[model samples]
Target: MQTIDMTEFQSIDLRIGTIVRAEDFAKTKKPAYKIWVDLGDLGIKKSSAQITFHYRPEELIGKQVLCVCNFAPKQIADFMSEVLVTGFSDIEGHIVLATGDKPIPNGAKLH
Candidate 1:
């Protein structure tokens, strides 16, 4: 693995946000969800998350999750994804969302 200095790690704008809305994204080649995250002062941001294999749209609401908020917006299909909802791959390759163990305020930095 490549080791990085603290500055490199600090440069990543990682934050926690609550999932306020989620819907099926049908226009994409792979199954994904169009999700809106409420990032407190940052306001609500849009994202396209490929978590359909392990999660349903309705179940995602109110879920607190980690996100990479500083990345440039990406256009996937017709959706312009703002923040990147972070997750890890399971043994079967399905994604499992990275979340806090307990409830936290929205837009909390991962320090």
Candidate 2:
């Protein structure tokens, strides 16, 4: 395993945000979703996530989730993803979103 100093770890701008919208990303090679997250004061950011196996667009709305806010925007197919919607792969290889256990204000930094 690798270890890092607290300062280094803190630099990873992980934050909590809410899913403001989600839709099928039909242009990507893999099945994915184009999602918009409302990060409170940070505003909304976009991401393309390969999470179609376990989630539906309608269900994702208003769901609170964790995100890597500092990553540079990436272009996937025609979509320009602005943030990374963090999650884990399930036993079946489907994604399970990373989310706060309880409701928290959007854009709250993870400590």
The TM-score that candidate 1 achieves is: 0.98
lDDT of 2 by residue, 14-60 (tens): 99999999999999998999999999999999999999988999999
Evaluated against the true structure, the overall lDDT of model 1 is 0.97
Q: Which sections of candidate 2 miss by over 4 Å?
A: none
* Residue range 1-111, candidate 1, lDDT tens digits: 999999999999999999999999999998999999999999999999999999999999999999999999999999999999999999999999999999999999999
Colliding residue pairs in candidate 1? none
Task: Supply the global lDDT for candidate 2.
Answer: 0.95
Question: How do the predictions measure up, each by TM-score?
Answer: 0.98, 0.97
**C-alpha lDDT of all candidate models, in order:** 0.97, 0.95
Worst 10 residues of 1 by lDDT: 102-111
Rate residue 87 of model 1 by lDDT. Answer: 99
lDDT of 1 at 54: 96
Q: Which stretches of candidate 1 lie over 4 Å from their true place?
A: none
**Backbone Cα, N, C clashes tallied per candidate:** 0, 0
